[model samples]
Every structure is written in structure tokens, then in C-alpha cells.
Target chain A: MEVIITKDLEKIYNPDTVPVHAVNGISTSFEAGEFTAIVGPSGCGKTTFLNLIGGLEAPTQGDISILGDSISTKKKSEMTDFRLHNIGFVFQAYNLIPVMSAYENVAFIMELLNRPQAEIKDRVMELLDAMGVGDKAHQRPHQLSGGQQQRVAVARALASKPKFILADEPTANLDSHATETLLDLMLKMNEKEGTTIIFSTHDIRVMNKARRLVKMDDGKIVENGKPDTA
Target chain B: MIAKLAWRNVWRNKVRSLVVIIATTLGISGALFIAALISGMMDKWVQNQIETELSDIQIHQEDFVIEEDQKFFFEKEDLERQLTAFANEIKEKAYRIKAEGLAMSAHNTYQVILLGVDPDQEPKVTNISNYIREGAYFKEPGRIKQILISQKLADELKVRMNSKVVINLSDIEGEIVGEAFKVVGIFKTSSGIFDESHVFVKNDEFAKVLKMKPGQYHELAIRTGEEVEVEAFQTELQQGLDADLMAESWIQMSPALKMTEGYMDTFNWILLSVVLTALIFGIINTMLMVVLERTREIGMLRSLGLNDRKVGLMFILETIYLSITGAIVGNILSFFLINYFGNKGIHFESWEEGFEAYGLQAVIYPILELNFYVLVTLLVFFTGLLASYFPVRKAIRLDISTAIRN
Candidate 1:
């Protein structure tokens, strides 16, 4: 089932002075349980496109439909609530709250959703153990390795059971081994939990793992198909 | 959880947070100490004036206070009879024959108010005897009429103990009369002006010199029981006095004392505001730094579904934690500091003359009521609220995409 649909989407930064077309005129849809990678060179608008889809930034012009409901018309406040319950995010920097332990960082989103304590605890530990970071659950972000931190980030994104996860350069700061480990963990979550995840990355190995690849240049998509074919 | 996060955030930059906390502690404690000091001084001033000069309440003929006229004397028997009804409230009372008179010595002359008192009864109503510095308080035997003159008046008149000072006044019949009274005691009080303008003499001698009838007095001073509310008692006592007599409390007699007592709280708040204003900027500066440094983390939180209101509330909570921690510590420190100083006393030996000029003691014991601690803490709490405004606004206004990119 199609989970997110973008119709003629566009984002223009500094529209009045020195305008930059970060994401322009892209229409696409992602299916549930799909592991997709948006691929491009530096400054080719992959992150911007992911941001637009995640509702982190409003497009200068477009209509976005999530699960058949239009989200482009939602207010900023409403959009935040929508994103909280529907879309989870992972940053390149493994942005777990520094003040929280790995377990607490994973549990943070569910807490925001006001889930029961027992449910949050079970889900957080289950996700951490699944991501292979359960032993590091009590360690703060700074005390964990980069790979371990990124694994915790992924667990946090999955904690609230969001409809989709949007990751921006999820492997950019990791070594080859950590990157492979993280990618394999994410692939397992996608297949087992049937979660749709769309991530932006230029890494060839990461792109190779995606079920589908959307290739972009400048601000528009140039290709979209099976990863090997694209 | 938000509160937990906020509290943890305060210790994130240990040195910076500690700096702000310590600054707040010193600022709040210093302001409170100064307030207590001023309160002590004022309390001493009011208490001294009441104990040594104006008793709790006084009654006089209706026109006596305004005119100081010898002819406005009231019959003492009438007030003595009415005293039986207020026996429980009345601690002691004394009658005084007050007259405007002039004192002349060989070298100088000054106008003074002559207070004629029965020495034994005067000590029961007021503490003038306790303040006698050089000579006995009406306990001497001499060949002439004896008087108690203040050291200040003696300085002006160039007289000493046992020196002859001629007092000139108008008799009740309106004729100018003069008499030589030997100065038997030289007293000094905290109030320089009071000392300079008042002298004490025997009521019998003063009445005889003024040609007044026996048992007639111009003023009747009443000392009430320590626990009695003077204002209420003044009202009750006023109602029982004869139509020709009027009763007044010390507050009515000394309006400045009443005004000072009323202004103290406002003065405390103003002092706190000045200190808090400075500390507020320090807090704002610290929170602003926290906001700027945590931009990426805050953006991450925001994008992770934390709403703007919660984010703002977290910042406010953090500021409150920082401020209240300091306030609690400061209040505890102030309690000890004030108590130590209250007992040991803060002496102002250098400013003794200046203080005595306004009827205040040279050494003051700091005092603060328990309610003041609660009120000051509330003020600091609100100050934290106020100090968080700009930082919370900045945090909420952050563009999540840009900030997360940072």
C-alpha cells in the first residue's frame, strides 16, 4: 500500500533574495514495508527531499498526502503532532539526547506519546536487543561507540512504532563495518516489522541495500526503479 | 520526565551553571541581609523613641499638645479614677507638668521644654533614668530646686552637674517668672534633638513656680502591657477619657515612625528587585548560551515530536531549577548569617553620631520574619520565570531543519 505521496513538490530557500531550489517538482510514492534509498551527489537535494517528506520543512509549493490524507495543508502545530505519531527521524550524527542513556533515548519518543510505562519499557528493550545494542542500553550517547549510538538512534525511531522512518545520511559518520552492521539491522527491521523507511545517502553500499533507489541531480529526480536497475 | 530532563540539563555545563548558581546565592543573600539591617535600624529607632520618650500612649488636655499652655492642665483625679476600668491593659502611668521654658547659664542660653515629673512614678512609665550618663537621676539633696538636664542642653548652656541654671517661664496667671534650679543630673539619649530640647524637674517645684493648682497636670503618659495592641488600646482609652482630654498612641504622636514601619516591605522588595535585576541578566546570559549550544539537540527533540510548548516549558523548568536551587541555599545561608549578626550585633561605631542624630542605636541586631523568607523565595521564583523569557522564545522559534543541520 502506498504510504506517502508527493505531488509536484518544491522547496525554495530565500525565495526573495538569492533563491536556491533545494527540492523541485518531484512527484513520487513509497509503499509500506519498502526499504528505499534516495541517492545523489553533494547538494543534490536528497536531504531536502527527505525533510519535505518528513514534514520537518514545509515545501514552498506542493501537496503531500500521507496514507491518503493531505498533510500539506496542516498547520505547523498539527504537522508536529502528525510527524510525532507517524514519522520518525535518524540524523547523520546519531542524535540521541546526550543527557539520556541509550535506553532512555529510545524510550523518549514513546514517553512523549504518553504510552504506558510497562509498554514503553518492553518496546524499548526489545528494539535495543533487536538492534544489538541492548547491552549498551544504560550507557549515555557520549559513552557509546558511533556504531552503537547510531543503533540506539534506529531503536528510538522504531520505538514509537511510526509508520515510516526518514533517515538523513544515516551511515555518513560510520566506518565500513559499523555502516554494514547498521544497514543490516535496518534491513532486518524493515522485513520483520514491515516498516517503510526512506533514507538519503550517497554511499554505494547503502544504496545497494535498498529495495528501490530514487536517483536525483540538482533538485529533481532523474531515475526511480529497482536498485540494480536504477 | 521533562522536569528530570531539565534538572539534568542544568548540570550539563557544570562550571557555567555553578557560576550562575553561586552568583544568585550571593546576590539574594546580600539583598536580604541589607534589608534586615535596615529593618533592625528602624526597629531600634521606633523602640528607643517609645521607651525613652513617648510611652505607648499619652493623654493630655485637648489643647495642651498644640499650645503647651500652662493653663490647659487637667485634673489628675479624674484620669486616676478612670484608670480602674483599664487596670488589665495599663502597665503603669505617670503625670507630667509640661511647660515651655528658657534655661540660662553664665555663658549661654537656650529655649527648652521643661518636663515636671514625680521622679518615682516617671521611671515606671519611661526609661529616661536608665539613660542618665553623668549624674544621678533626681537622687540628690541640695539647698535649691533640682533639675535633670541633658548633656546636649548642658553643652549649649555651658553648664555641668550641680551648676545653677535659671529657668524662666510664664506662670498660669500669664506673668513671666524665673527660678534658679541646680542641675543635679546630666543625661544623654539616642535622640540628639530630644536631648537638646528637654529638661526634667520636680512636678511640685514646677507647679509652684508656675503658680498652678496642686494635682493638675498637662500630660498623662500611659505604658501598656507589652502584648497589648497599642492602636486598639488607644482607641478604647480615647473613648473613656473626658471630653476635654484626648488620648494618642505613639504612632499618632510620631507619624514618621508609622510611615517607616509601613514602607519597610516595599523597601525590601525594591532592594530585592535591584539585586534580582542584575542576577536576571546573568541568568538570561547563561540560558541563552545553553540555547545556542544545544541548538542541534533541541532541534532533534523538536523533530522527534516534542512540541514547542513542551520545549519552552522545559527551558522554563530548567531556569526555575537553577534559580530555586540557589534561592534555597541562599535563604539557608542568610538564616545563619542573620542569626549570627543578630546576636553578635553589627556595630557602626564610626556612624554613631549620625545614627544618634536620628534616634537610632549605634549597634543594630538584624532581624527578619519567617514570612519574609517565603516571600523572597517567591520573588526569586518569579524572577526565574521572567529570566527564562528570551531563551524560551529563542528555543521555540528555532527552524528545526536548519537547527538539526547545525
Candidate 2:
């Protein structure tokens, strides 16, 4: 099932003084359980497109429908609620709360969802173990290596059981070894849990790991298909 | 969960948070201590006056209160019997003959209020006996009438203890009577003015010279039980008195003290406003910095589904934690500081003369009520809430996409 569909999505910066079309008329959709990567050079509007889909920012024009509900029609506060209930995010820097332990970071999303403590505990441990970070559950983000922190971040994203996860450059800061580990953990989550994930990356290795790839340049998709075919 | 996050967030920057907490502690405690000092000073002044000069309650012939003439006198026997009925509330009662008179010595003459008292009964009602700086309170035994003059009057008249002074005053029949009295005691009180304007003599000798009977006394002073409500007791005593007489509590007799007591609350709030105002700014500055420093973290939380209200609540909780922690420590510190200084006393010996002129002692005992501490803590809590406004707004207004990039 298609979880996200963008219809001619657009975002313009400094529209009045000097309009810059960051995401110009993008059209796309992602199926559930697809480990998809949107690949492009720097400033190619990959993050903006993800943000539009995640309801983190409003598009100057066009509609982003997540599970058949158009997010462009929602108010700012309503959009925040929508984001909390339906979307989970993983940033390039692995933005896990520094003050929280890995377990706590994973549990935080479910807590925000108001899930029961017992259920949150079971789910958090399950996800942490799946990500191969169960033993590091009690360690804060600062105490973990880059790969471990990214794994924790993935667990946090999956904790909410959202329709899809939006990851922005999930491995840009990691070494090749850490990047390989994080990608494997994410691929495991995608296969085992059927979690639809759409991430933005410039790394060829990351694009290679994606089951599907959408290649972009100058804020428009140049290609979209299987990674090898694309 | 929000509270936990906020609390842990406060300690994220230990040095910055500690600076705010310590500043709040000093501000709140300093305000409370200053308030206690002033309160103690005022309370002690009124108490001292009531104990040493004006007994807790006083009764006089209505005409005598209106006009300070020797002719206006009360029937002592009947009034004494009436006062005894309140024995449970009235600890001690004394009757006195008060006259506007002049004390003449070889060197000088001074106008004074000549108070004729039964020394034994007078000492029971008032603490003047304890203030005797030289000799004893009417202790000399002689056919020559003995008197007590304040050290202030003694200095003015160039007389010492046992010096001879002449008492000249009006009798009840409006006749001028002159009599010789030897100063047996020289007393001093906290009030320099009270000391200079009053002289005491034996009631029998005073009455003999004035050609009056013991029953015709001008004033009746009663020291009531501390636990008794003074105003209510005064009203009850007044209702029980004869139509020709009137009773007054110390507050009624001294309106200035009453006014000062009323102003104390206003004074406390003013001091708290000054302290809390400073505290509010300190919190705002610190919290603004917190928001600025945690932009990316806050952005991450926001992007992770933390709603605007929850984000605002988290910052509010953080501000409250900082302020309340300081308030709790500040109040505890104030409690100990007030009690310590209250017992030890804070002396201003250099200003002794100025303080004494207004019936105040040089040393002041700091004091505060339990309700005041509770009030200050609540003010600090509200102050925390108020101080959180700008920071909460700043946090909630962050651009999630832009902040994440930071």
C-alpha cells in the first residue's frame, strides 16, 4: 500500500525578494516496506522534499498525502499532532536526546504516543535487540559510537510504529564500517517489520543498499525505479 | 515524563543552572532577612513601650483622659474591685495619681509629669523598676518624701541620686501645693524623651501634700495575659467600667504603633517585589540562553512528535524547577538566619541615641511569621511561571527544519 504520495510538491525560499524554487513540482509515491533512497548532489532539495512529506514544513504549493490525508490542508498545530502520530524522523547527525539513555530515547516516542509502560518496555527492548544495540540500551547518546547512536535513532523511529520513516542523510557522518552496520540494521527492520523508509543520501554505498532509488537534480527527479535500473 | 526531561535538562549545563539557582537563593533570602529585621525592630519598639511605660490596658476618668488636670480622678476602691473580676486575664493592676507639675532643684527647674505610685504595686504592673540605673526604686526609708527621677531629668537639673528636689503641683481643690522630696533613684529607659519628662514619688506622700484620699486616683493600669486578645479584652473591660471612666488598649492609645503594624505587610511585599523582579530577569536571561543553546535538540524533539504545548510545558517545568529549588533552599536559609540573628540581636550602638529617642532599643531582634515564608515561596513559584513566558515562546517558535540543520 502506498503510504506517501506527493502531487506536484513545491517549496520557494524568500519568495517576495528573491524566489528560489527548492522543490519544484515533484510527484512521487512510496509503498509500505520499501527501503527507498532519494539520491542527489548537495542543495538538490532532497531534505526539503522529505520535510514536506514529514509535515515539518509547509509547501508553497502542492499537496502531500500521507495515507490519503493531504497535509497541506492541516494547520500548524494540527500538523504537529499529525507528525507525532504518523511520522518518525532520523537525522544525519543521529539526533537522539543526549540526556536520555538509548532505551529511554527509544521509549520516548511511544511515551509521546501515550502507550502503556509495559508495552513500551517490551517494544523498546525488541527493537533495540533487533538493531543489535540491546546491551547499550542504558547508555546515553554521547556514550555510544556513531553507528550505535544511529541504530538507537532507528529504534526510536520504529518505536512509534509510524506508516513510514523519513531519514535525512542517515549515514553521512558515519565511517564506512558504521555506515555498513546502520544500513544492515535498517534493512533488517524493513524486512522483519515491513517498515516503509524513505531516506535522502548522497553516498553511493547508501544508494546501493536501497531496494529502490529516485535520482534527482535541480529540485526535480531525473529517474525513479529499482536501484540497479535507476 | 516532561518533568523528568525538564529536570535533567536543567543540569545539562551545570555551571549556568547553578549560577541562576544561587542568584535566586541570595535574592530571596536577602529580601526575607531585611523584612524580618524591620519587623523585629518595629515589634520590639511597640512591646518595649507597652511593657515599660504604657501597661497593656489603662483606665481613667473620661475627664482625665480628655483634660490632664489633677481634679479629674477615679474612685480607686470601686475600680480596683471591678478590675479583680478579670483576674484570669489581668495579670497585675496598679492605681496612680498623675499630675502636671514642676521639679525644682538648686541648679535648674524642669516641667514633668509627676506620677504618684505605690512602689510595690507600680513595679508589678510596669517594668520601670528594672530600669533603675542608680539606687533603688523608692527604697529609701525616711520621713522626708522620696522620689525617683530619670537620669535625663537628673542631668538637666544637675542632681544625682539622693539629691533634694522640690515637687510643686495642683491639689484636687485647685490649690497649689509645694513639697520637698529627695531623689532616691535615678532611672533610665529606652526612650530618652520618656526619661526626661517623668518623675515618680510615693502615693501616700503625694496624696498627703495634695490633701486627697487614696480612693481618688487619676489612672488605673492593668497588665493583661499575653494570650488574651488585647483589643477584645480592652472592649470587654471598657463595657464593664463605670459610665464616667474609659479603658484603652495600647494600640488604641498609641495609633502610630498600630499604623506601623499595618504598614509591615506592604513593606514586606515591596521588598519581595524588588527581589523577585531581579530574580525574574535572571531567570529570563538564563532560560533564553537555554533555548538558544538547545535549538537543535529542541528541533529534534519537535520533529519527533513533541507538540507545541508539550514543548512549552517542558520549558515551563524547567524554569519552575530552577526557581523552586532556589526558593526551598532560600526559605530554609532564611529560617535559620532569622532565628540566629533574632536570638543574638543585631546591634546599632552608634545610633543608640537616635533609636532611643523614638522609644526603640539599640539592639533589634529579627522576626518573621510562618505565613510570610509560605507567601514568599508562592510568590517565587508564580515568579517562575512568569519568568518562563519568553523562553517558552522562543522554544515553540523554533523553525524545525532550519534548527535541525544548526
Candidate 3:
């Protein structure tokens, strides 16, 4: 079943003065448990499209539905609550709160959701262990390597058990080795837990690992296709 | 966890946080110390006025207070009967024959209030004998037909121990009379005006010169050991006395002293407000910097679903922590300093003339009422919250996407 649908989605920057169309007339849908990559060049609007779908920014004109609930019409505060409960995000910078330890960063979202302490701790430990950063849980983000911090970030994203995770250039700051390890861990989470993951990136390695690719250029999708295993 | 986060945030920039904390500490302690100093000075002024001058209560003929004519004197038999009625409450009492006169020496002449007192009874009621800087009080064996003059008066008249001065005044019969008396004692008191304008003489000698009937005096000064009961005792005395006489407490006798005591709290609050205003700005600047520096982090938290209220609460908690910590330290240090100085006193010997002009001693014992400390603590707490308000509003108004981008 399609968990997210976008219809005629559009975003324009500096709308009145110098209208820059970032995302224009895009209609798309993603199914549950699908690992999809939205790939493009640097200014092709991949990040803006991701932001529009994640409800981080409102569309200039269009509608986005997550789990069949239209989110574009919601108030800013209502949208925040909806996003908290439904969509998990991973940023390129792995923005873990510097003051909190790795475990606290992951558990913080669960705490926001008011999850029981026992369940939050158990799930947090399980996610950290699965991401191969369980031993680093007590350390702050600065103490962990880049790859380890990214793993902790992914663990934080999954802590709330949202319907899907939206990652924007999740490997943009990582080295080749760290990028490979982070991608492997994200893929494992996808396959093992039947979790849906949609990532926007210009990186070929991310596109190569995806089960499906949607290519965009100049704010419009040019191609959507399943990658051939052969 | 939120509180924990806020607490940790306070110490994140050790230097910045310490600056605010120190400013707050200094502001609180400084205001409190100044308040204590004012209170101490006021206390000394009131004490001196009572001990060396007013005593607790005084009685005057109804007309005498309005008109200082010597003829307004009350019969001593009636005064003695009223004193006997309140004998249980009276600690010490004295009758005085008072006259407005001019005292002249070889070098200078000054207007003075001449007081004629029974030397032995006067010492029981006031500290005049103790304040004598040279010579001796009226009762000394060789000091017959003598006067006790203030050092200020002696200085102005250029007279010394055993110098003779002439007191010119009207007698009870409305005739102007001049009497020459040897200056047997020179007294110095904290009140410059009192020292310059008053001289004491033997009441018997004064009566003999004025040709006054026996058992008649112009004023009665009473001292009561139970200070809190002074006003009540005054009221009782007024009711029991003859209709022509009036009894007045020290507060009634000196309106300026009453006003000063009443305005002390208002003065203290104004002082605290001025200090707290400066402190509030310092705190706001510090907290605003903290918010600006953590813009990205705050945006991340908001993106993670922490509501505006929680973000505001976090900032407020941080401010309160800083304020409370500073207040605690400040109060502790102030208490220590106040106690030390309250005992040893802060002496302004160099400013003796200036202090004496206001009837205050040079040595001030710093004092703070217990309630004043509690009020200061409460004020600091509320000040913290007030100072945080603007910064918290700014933090909550941030656009998450823009903040995260920054």
C-alpha cells in the first residue's frame, strides 16, 4: 500500500521578488517497505522535494498525504505533532545534540513521544546494537567517529517507530569507508524490519544501493524505474 | 531530563555564565549592604535622639508646646501625682525648668535653650553626665551656681573648663533677667544642633533667680524600659493628667525621625530596583547570547517535536538556576559581612562632623531585618524569570528550518 502520496507538489523561493521554482508539479507515490532514492544534480531540487514531503516546509501549491491523511492543510503546530508521530528524519550533518550522550540522543525522541522508560531503553539499546554502535551509546557525538555518529542518528530516527524515514544527503559528509558502513547499516534496517526508507541524494553509491530510483532535473522528475539486478 | 539539559547548558560557556553569576552576586550583595548601612545609620540617629535628648516620653503644658513662654509651667505637685500613678511603668523621670535665652561669652553670643534640672535626677533620665568631655556635672562639690555647656557652644564662645558665661532670659513674671554662671562642664554629643543650642543649669538656682513658686516646672521627661509600650503609656498618661497638660511619645515629639523610620522600606525597595535593573539587563544579554549560539541545536530540538513551551521552559530554567545560585552565594556572603560589621561597626571618624550634623554617631552598626533578606531572595527569583522572558520569546519564535540551516 502507498504510505505517502504527493500531488502537484511545488515550492518556490523568493516567490514575489525573483520567483525561483524549486519543486514544480510533481506527482508521486511511495509504497510501504520500499527503499527508494530520489537522485539529481546539486540544484535539481532533490532536497526541497524531500523537505516538502517530510512536512518540514509548506508547499506553495499542492497536497501531500502520509498514510492517507492530507498534511498540507494542517496548521504548523498540528503538522509538527503529525511529523513527530509519523515521519523520522536523518540530516546530512548527523545533528545529534552535543550535550547528550549517544543513548540520550536516540532516547530523546522516544521520551518526546512519552514512551515508557523500560521500552524506550530496550528499543534504544536494540537499535544501537543493530547499527553496530551499541558500545558507543554512552559517549557524546564528538567522541564517536563520523560513521558511528551517523549510525546513532539513524538509531534516533527509528526510535519513534515512524511509518518511514526521510534522509537528506545522509552520507554527504562521510568518507568513502564511513559512507559504505552507514549505507550498509541503513539497508540492513530496511530489509530486516520491513521499514520504508526514502533518501534524496546526488551520490551514485546511494542510487546504486536503492531498489528503485526516481531521477529529477530542474525541479521535474525525468525518470522513475526499478534498478536491474543483472 | 529537560531540567538536566538546561542545567548543563548553563555551564556550557563557563566564562559567559560566570560573568552573569558574578554580576548578579555583586548586585545583590551590594544593594543589601547599602541597605544595611542606611538602616544602621538611622538606628544610631534614633538611639542618640532618644538617649541624649527626647527619652521615651515627655509632658508639657498644652500651651507650652505651642508657646515656649516660661509662664506655661505646670505645678510640680500635679506632675508628681501623674508620675506616681504610672510608677510601675516608669524607669526614670526628671522635671526640668526650660527657657529660651541667649548665652553670651567674651567672644560670642548665640541663642540657646536653657535647661534647669535637678542634677541627680537628670542623670537618671538622660546620658548628659556620660557625654561630658571636660569639667564635671552640676552636682560636683565645688561647682555651685554652675552650668554644663556643650563643646560646640564652648568652641563658638571660645570658653573652656571653668569659664563664666551669662544666660539672659525672661523670668516667670515676664521680666527679662540675666544670670552669670560658671561653665563647670563641657559635653559633646552626636547631635551638632543639640550641642550648639542647649545648656544645663541647677534647677534650684534657676528657680531662686526666677522667683518661681515651689513645685513648678516647665517640662517632664520620662524614660520607660519597655520601649514598645511608650506610645500606649503616653496615651494612658494623657488620659490621667489634668486637662491643661499633654503627654507625647518621642515619635510625636520628632516628626522627622518618625518619617525616616517609616520610609526605610521604600528606600530599600528603590535601591533594590536600581540594582536589579542593571542585573536584569546583564542576565538578558547572557541568555540571549546562549540562545543565539545554540540556534541550530534549538532548531534541531524543535524539529524533533519539542514544542515551543518546552523550549521556552528550558531557557527559563537555565536563567532561574543561574539566579538562584547567585542569590544563595550572595546572601551567604552578605550575612557574613553584615554580622561582622554589625558587631565591629563601620566607623566614619573622618566624617564625624557630617554625621553629627544629622544627629548620627560616627560608628554605624550595619543592620538588616530578617524579612528584608527573605524579600531579596524572592525578588532575585522573580528577577530571573523576568530577565529570561525576552530571550525565551526569541528562542520560541525561531523558524525551525532556517535555524537548522544556520
Clashes of each: 0, 0, 1
What is the per-candidate TM-score for chain B? 0.95, 0.96, 0.93
lDDT of 3 by residue, B1-406 (tens): 8998899889888888887888888889989998999898888788888988898999999898988788898998867876687888889989999888999999999999988898889988889999989988865545457999999999999999888899888898889899888988999999998999999988888887677776889889989976548888889889989999989999999989989887985798899999888888888988898889999888778877788878999999999999888887888888889999999999999999998888889999999988888889899999999999999999988887777778
Higher-ranked by DockQ: 2 or 3: 2
Indicate the docking level reached by candidate 3. medium
The DockQ of predicted model 2 stands at 0.85
CA lDDT of each candidate? 0.92, 0.91, 0.89
Clashing residue pairs, backbone N/CA/C < 3 A, model 3:
B76-B215
State the lDDT of candidate 1 residue by residue for B128-208, as single tens digits. 899899888896545799999998899888898889999998988899999999988999988888999999999988899
Q: Rank the candidates by lDDT, best first.
A: 1, 2, 3
Off by over 4 Å in 1: B140-143, B261-266
Cα lDDT of model 3 by residue, A84-108, tens digit: 8988889888999988999999999
The TM-score of candidate 1 is 0.96
Instruction: Give the per-residue lDDT of model 2 (tens digit) for B1-406.
Output: 8999999999999998899899889988999999999899888988888888788999988988998777888787788777777879988888888898889999999999988898889998888899999999987468799999999899999999878999888888898888999989999999998999999988888888888786778888889887999999999988888888899999988988889877986888898999999999999999999999899999999998898999999999999999999998999999999999999999999999999898889999999999989989999999999999999999999999998988
The better candidate by TM-score, 2 or 3, is: 2
Residue pairs with backbone overlap in model 2: none
